[model samples]
Target: MSAKTKNKHDQSESPRLGASAFSARSKRVTVNMGDGQKVKTLTPKQRGATTEQKSVAKDVKKVMAKCKEEHDMRLDLSRCEVTELPRYIKELSHLEEMYLYGNRLTTLPPEISSLLNLKILALSENMLSSLPDEAESLLCLKVLDLRHNRLKEVPFVVYQLRSLQTLFLRFNRVTSLTPEIKNLTQLTTLSMRENKFKELPEEIGYLRCLSVLDVAHNHLEHLPHSIGNCNQLVTLDVQHNELVDLPETIGCLTCLKRLGIRYNRIREIPAELEKCSDLEEFNIEQNKLKTLPEGLLKRFKNCSSLQLARNQFEEFPSGPPAQFGPLTSFSIEHNKVTIVPFGVFSEAKKLTKVHLKDNLISSLPLDFGSWVQITELNLASNQISKLPDDIKHLTKLEVLILSNNVIKLLPKSIGGLCNLIHLDLEGNRLESLPAEIGYLTSLTKLSVQSNRLTVLPRGIGHLVNLKHFSAGENNLTQLPEEMGTLESLEELYLNDNPNLQMLPFELALCRKLALMSIEGCPLGRLPPQVVDGGPSAIIMYLRTQGPYRAMSFS
Candidate 1:
């Protein structure tokens, strides 16, 4: 009747899938990952020089001469301490681009305007508090980057750049922009993040070509209604502001796709957002909204991901509207959701992840297990009591976390989860697990700590892939010696099993064992030296009982 002896006997009679068959099924659950695509930035040009290019900071004269020799060339003097531009730079007026970023220059010399061929000018990260009026003479300039400077206001002369397409003014002291900023009709990207702009000029709406606008971390309390005039705007970021409400006109941006307004004082989502049909990702976490406006979810039907964490929601909305069918990921953690409507997730076929952790839900819907496509299901730290038997429908599940709950038993069908890799049942009232647990051959981490279990199924030995096992603070009088079959085991914890009487000699055979805890167990079989010794010594002493005698660490 010994567990290990019984396990070996069962292995002969039991019907199990062969490696070749299991490999085919595993492929059905596992997806072939593709190479990640490189992010495409909206910067006008790539910064930094090629590895073979020498630094041209020490001698602008020689570098400028090279630019003159070539009708069109680039001159980079960025990251150098050059305080002034030599008047000779005016001779290389044909230079197509100029870079003077990260320097000690306080002003742009009037002579810099002589570069009529300059198209890209990067003068960021300097001590510039003012720009020279002559800078306006470069009519061919298309990109202007003056970010990370001490300028309290954008130089009025910059408004004269009728050909500029991109402008950056982030991390500056610019508090006001002249009305003439609207004259940059060709601008496509404008950044003013981390600035002192208390208010944006209405003229910003005149940039019809503007597609991206970032103004996060500012003191603005309101946006002008005219901002809605940017009909081509695609991405808008205005997080960490004092705005109590968004201009109703914001819904005018029919092309907007992504909008982030987290950490704001907004109390409600504007009804006008119904016009934003293309809005894909909407982040409005950490706001003061208590009740979601009705029909709001029906507005952004195309949003793939939505986050409403850390809000004052007492109960989740009742039904899963058809509009939410396309969602891939959803989160409502750290809320007061007492009940999650069964219909809320019934339609989410493509939903890959759902996080409702740290909620007040006491029980799941009887059909909760119907969600089979989910790869990661985190319902930890809830008041759930029992899992429904149908949970086996999630055959593709990889991570199942039910820790810190009142779950008393796992469904016998849990073994059907052939792809499960991690299972956590800690801090539960479970008295026992289904022997079917042995069927989870893919399991790598299993934790049943702080439970009321008196014993584990002998079939646990079937988990040949297990690497870590935690079973502390249980009522077990004996551990199944079959656990020694975990050849891949690395860390094991069996502390606080007060009634345990002996050690499993077979455990010493686990060569991959590195950490083991067996404290609080009264075992007279082990010598005082072996008992006082740590995992290595205990393992070494046990191995001596066999034919292999070896020294080990404390």
Candidate 2:
């Protein structure tokens, strides 16, 4: 009873059908039973009906012939303009789940292999190009979607369906895969994403109980070193392929875990993935990796989220395994890391989110406390002007991005970071802000967007959980009328503070203010009492202003 009280009682017991009452209700109202008495009416059209409508049509044909003699038969002709299918549907013969998806069906009816207790067969978005070698006699088919069909070639009797296990042929004009699909061997999730597959059927390593293999946006360059013999593969999404190199027998699968080779032209990293020791989330973002195979982080010593951001790393890579155990989220953002090496993140120690944003670091190792379980520190576009006052020992910091740094000042020990929550210091040259940053108090998103702030720290109304306050491109000419006591501010961007003119009739006592940008502020207008106490205010009010602009919510 508590999941936010069952999602507010299922959003107050859901029932919201309005697109013109669901496009004029195409059948969905029913209730009628009798002889003992129970009835409600809507459907009534059995021409020449009498004698209690012929005994209610013989009790609905004896309950649909006892539900087609138990189970089976479940047909849904999607978007029904139904082109074909009624050869009395092969006399039902215990049909089982057949949905001809978004149809204009080009063909299909070798009497649909006489149903044979079919088990899920959806000819996806059809205009089907083939598939009726009696579809290999169903044999209790088990899931075959045939995605976006205009199929060039897929039915090698669908790998002789020995009880198929999920095979969705994505956007098909299928270019390959029928070496009799190495006889399916009980496939376990094989989606040929955006197909026209240019390679991939070295008998796809004979299935061997495959586990989720998505050939992402294909035209794959190379990949069938018998796909490293499938060893129960676990999620291998080949991103935007044209992969230049990979089949170092993909380090023999060793139960691979989430490996997305992003936008490849691969420049390195295949030291045969150091035998994928249970790899855990590794996305080689936009590849062309320059230098990183010095035993590739000591062979991902149980990696835990490593996205070598943007690539061609100029530094920061000394084979992560001086006992580097279970790393925790590390992104070497935009690279060419100028200098951050001094015990380079001292054995990671369960590091917590560190993305040295657009680096060229001028200074930081005043013992950056080997990242004391850091919490989201992105040193945004660096050339650091000053920070290491032992950075007040991070103390599980919560998002401190330091946007475009050249910091003019700040370290009032950053209000001893009482779990700071998002503080961006946007495009800095900060003129002010450390009156101990109004004592942090779990600050909630505060960005001094493009700074040179002329004023603001009148104890920022003691940050009672501030809620999004961005001094847009500053040179602020006014604002601390205790910022209308913030009362849970909800967005107040203060655009281009060109000597901000009005705005502090105690900010109309804040009443959860909802957005007020004050565009190019020298405010020749806008204080009809902060526009009538922000009736969900969104005033950008600009009347003729020049120069002095700034608004970067980065």
Best by TM-score: 1
Q: Write the per-residue lDDT of candidate 1 for residues 1-554, one digit (tens) a residue.
A: 36586345323322221221000000112223456755443321143332212233335556566667865467776655556777778887878777776666788778988988888888777888988889888899888887778989888998998898878787788887889998899988787877888888888889989998888888888888988999899988898877788898998999999998888888877878768888898778777766666666657778888787777778874344565677888888777889987667777778887888889889888777788898888898989998888888999899999999999989899999999999999999999988999999999999999999999999899999999999988988877888778989999999998887777877876778899888887766678777878667778877787444453313
- Find the candidate with the highest lDDT and give its number: 1
What would the per-residue lDDT of candidate 2 be over residues 1-554, giving only the tens digit for each residue?
25575335322322221121001112323455656666654542422344444544454344345546766366544544344554545666687776656556777788778888988887777788877788688888878887777888787778888788888877677888867788888878788867778898788898879887888878888888898888788889888888877878888888888888888788876777778878777888887887766766666667788888887788777754453557788888987788886766777788788888987887887568557788888989989998877777787899999899898998888788789888888998989887888888788889888889888878998887788988887888888777767778888888888887665555555556667676677654555654444424422221112121132112
Model 2 residue pairs with clashes: 73-95, 297-320
Off by over 4 Å in 1: 1-60, 78-85, 100-107, 124-129, 149-153, 173-180, 318-320, 472-479, 493-505, 514-554
TM-score of each candidate structure, all chains considered together: 0.80, 0.37
| Residue 377, model 1: Cα distance from true site in angstroms | 1.4
Ten-residue region with minimum lDDT total, candidate 1: 20-29
Lowest summed lDDT across 10 adjacent residues in model 2 is found at 16-25
Candidate-wise lDDT, in order: 0.79, 0.73
